[model samples]
Target: MAASSAVEPTSFDPSKAYKEWEVNGKYFGDGREVALLDYIYNHPDIEQLRGNPEKILRAIDAFAQSVTGLINIGENKGVIVSDVIAQHKPEVVLELGGYIGFSAIMFGSAMKRAGGKQYYSVEKSPLFAAVATSLIDLAGLRDTVRVVVGTGAEGIQRLYDNGLLRSQIGMAFFDHHKPSYTADLKLCERLGLIGKGTVLVADNMILPGNPPYVEWVRASVEDKRAMDKAAQEKGNPNLQYNSRFVKSFEPSGMEDALEITECLGIEGA
Candidate 1:
């Protein structure tokens, strides 16, 4: 009989290649995102804190768990939205969808880093609001970030009632239902929540595209161009309008992930 060679052990370490596998798998692989988020939430360093630290850590954990565990686990749109807010260092932030406060934490963290900023998240789901409120309290951001339970439109009225609209809102994030994006934008405009140089970011623009809203923006840009042309024809001052779409894709193994589209509103134009 021929001598049999010793079989080498398979070196398939899940943790070592987890990220590669995750991206290749297209953001869907046995709840990997959820597991990772849970790990972060339940980390020992975050758990062992006392007083404010402990509360903040708990809020962070709750928020992560609420989004990844309860809502769609593959929804990683928060990354892009959070990154934009963090980079801009906005003084005031308004988020459309609170969703267990995951995005709220990201915004709050960004605001904290930027210094002297506050975030107000509006969530329609009462359950999510409850969870988020608890998490916000735990995260010790009760002073910096406020979670309001209601849609943006409804919350706008409440904000006015509470005298919160006086502060200039620098950034706005839209992550609620796709159909509500345009409506919410209009609502914000009517309520004067967005200023001239305000930054408005909409997530999932491609995967779950909002055709009406997208078309509206296109038409508005065309109208602005026409206005500028008409002004030039009449020897009147031509004001230029700026509009651009930023395309961002979340790295996930799944084919359908998150897409972030940002639109900047020029005040005087």
Candidate 2:
């Protein structure tokens, strides 16, 4: 890995604690996503939500706050990625998860505003993907975003096989299975989806730390090469990365952070 990137600003206010009901529990797949859609579609301000990402996001936030809590990359952490998008101006943004299309709509809107072409939200659950597609279409971003239903690796391969993601992936966002973060990233590395100038944003660093993924991104190139023999997957050890830990608040008001890693270049090429 390359030298770590310097964290910025160095100033942050105390974030409010999440409401007791705001944190997620073992209550997914109970049609909460559908309830969110119902709430949005039935709102008196539904007309104003059309083609309005902000309003749509507000509606989602409203559902999460007033209703059941959703496990999403909430407004706080979301802004961090949007700032990254503004700086990188990636032509395409790929997300490993798209729970109910919250992050998809949020970041997809940012990508479009930044003059990017596409934002791909890959969700393994077909049900969630369907719900996301409906919400994304409702946001009138059907052209700017697409929801792929499959595992992260499958999603990458499907896109690559179809030639929609042949060149370097401008940005990759990881917010899926905690343990698979490194494995999925390695798959992308193997497929050459990630390259120089690529930005990788991974969620759930503090709340549920991922040492393997963080170690891989923060390791020295020589260290990575040495560790390659013990790895289960064969990612390019030569891909140099510059990582930074950006602290932020989870939607539940719990302290969390995103690991923003940039592929500076391949090492010893």
Who wins the TM-score comparison?
2
Cand. 2 Cα-lDDT: 0.87
lDDT (tens digit, per residue) of candidate 1 on 137-214:
666778888888888778767886788866447777777878887777666655666554566666665566677555
Q: Per-prediction TM-score, please?
A: 0.64, 0.93
- Cα deviation in Å at residue 192, candidate 2? 0.8
Q: List the pairs of residues colliding in candidate 2.
A: 1-220, 1-221
Estimate candidate 1's alpha-carbon lDDT, on a 0 to 1 scale: 0.56
lDDT of each: 0.56, 0.87
Q: Which ten residues in a row have the lowest lDDT in candidate 2?
A: 10-19
- How many clashing residue pairs appear in each of the predictions shown? 14, 2
Off by over 4 Å in 2: 5-25
